[model samples]
Target: MSDLVWTRGVEWLAAAASDPRACKRDWDRGEGIALLEAGRFWDVLSVPDQLGLLTLDLLWRPTLPVPGPTLVDTAAHRVGFFLPPDPDSKWIGAGLRHAGEGSWVAVPPPYRSTRFLEWLIPPDGTGELHSPTTLELALRQANGSLSVLAPLCGG
Candidate 1:
């Protein structure tokens, strides 16, 4: 949107989990990397997926390796990672910014004791900054060989 500095054409992204345990829960159910941010509670920006429209979760950079097809946002200081659709899902390379209330809810990075939170430029009240990382490097880190930081999930 005009408000935020985000990159378009990013193939995919990953965000910090609202509940780390939930990520494990969904993954445990065979749902690879699904998040509550990707569910109906948030006004998700969606693209076409194998199932239909895969609701994309918000992230600036990735703290954890999101093993799937993905794109990166160079701005926002890579403060988080955007969760992508499934690896095989074909993204349309397009999305719409949510404008109405209760749409595009806060999808923060995993909480930490040391790091401080930052907002999207042109600040919108959202979640805390977890591990801010660019999406492209994150993909490489996820799939390729790169030492990276692990995602946090508060206990």
Candidate 2:
């Protein structure tokens, strides 16, 4: 499964986006279906229960099949997700500086039942002010233009 998806979409994406991590192979070949990259896993998330975790960037929560189709069909697409290579991958910092640009996107709360924005990565990449996405700093590009990088894991 990993080899298949990685070859189809991730391969071209990795080169097009210039983010090899997105196409990195899971050599370990662990278990529980790889939802994204190497660490992200796909859990039986029937409903998005963790809205607080949402952010203006991208959301990659394990999702379970609703009520139709089958596991094989859903996993083929839903399970394998992707996002632009951001500060997390150590590429933005190496290429762009923080003062170049910034963007702010309002991350809608999951479950489609919330009335507030779970999180918002300020135009200057200050979304980490509330919760850090592992990067010590989030460098936003000028005029919110990343050239090719995607903001989050999901499209």
Candidate 3:
């Protein structure tokens, strides 16, 4: 189930973008998936309520490297989820960071801010697309449930 969840998340990320060229898989060794775009790195396979989204920039390097994923706890605190290099295990994490050229910002809770914009998942209870602020608010209100957070973020 973990592997499935992780894989699904990666798939969702690949599908989220209208331009397939924007999503590139640098590595997928059954242990985890590594995606890249515009020289930025996104390595976490995040499954929020069956919606998959990847975190970018935290693991950028010139060589193959594995950075731990972020995991939100029940207390709504964000932390890292490091996993051993195993093919059969799924590591869950919280608070995905958005990384770009020499700049990175930690995504706020999906229920509190609307700065994290996503083009994949639609807004909840409304047909309108999600804005970054709305997604952050949703994340804050989700109590660390990725299932709840992912949808609001358009994953």
Candidate 4:
């Protein structure tokens, strides 16, 4: 990404924090990640790393792609996908967690990936987010595939 585009994306990501300045200061101080509150600008839906990876592939394979900012916590074995905030949306599935309306999420700088925490798909500063319905469907498909493959993989 160009410097200007990345700068805009970083700015957009930082705006999610209550104190955007503090987050920027921490980043400037070499902190790898900052905790940003959810529900203000957007919400996060997180799932197990394996399922998330599968969902991501499914999401991107469509003719009309569902692109969104995505984060992966390797150490935690989870992945977070950014979505537009909706108080009424209650996501349900095993290993699925929603960070919305008062929850907080650890966010990495948009420009690059850090140790343990990285962005699978970085924000583009356009404020675009994944469609909740599309993501839900993809997650279901991914979960089904995993269930079928688990026995074969001996997991």
Q: Pick the candidate with the highest lDDT.
A: 4
Q: Write the per-residue lDDT of candidate 4 for residues 1-155, one digit (tens) a residue.
A: 89987888889999998888888776666756889999988999999999999999899975857579999999999999999999887898888999999899988888877678899898888899998988988899999999999999999
**For each candidate, what TM-score against the reference?**
0.21, 0.17, 0.22, 0.95
lDDT of each structure?
0.28, 0.22, 0.32, 0.89
Rank order by lDDT, top first? 4, 3, 1, 2
Model 3, 39-83: lDDT tens digits are 133322233422222222222334423333333322232232222
Which candidate, 1 or 4, has the higher lDDT? Answer: 4
lDDT accuracy of residue 77 in candidate 1: 24
| Residue 8 shift from truth in candidate 1, angstroms | 24
Cα lDDT tens digits for candidate 2, 33-78 = 2222221211111111111112112232243211110011222121
Better of 1 and 3 by lDDT: 3
**Candidate 1 whole-model C-alpha lDDT, 0 to 1:** 0.28
Candidate 1: misplaced stretches above 4 Å?
A: 1-15, 38-155
Weakest 10 consecutive residues of candidate 3 by summed lDDT: 121-130
Top TM-score model: 4
**Candidate 1 structure quality by residue, lDDT tens digits, 1-155:** 32231221111123334555565444334423243344322222222221111111332326443222222222222222233223232323323222122223332222111122222221122321122233333333432221222233221
lDDT for model 3 comes to: 0.32
| Candidate ordering by TM-score (highest first) | 4, 3, 1, 2
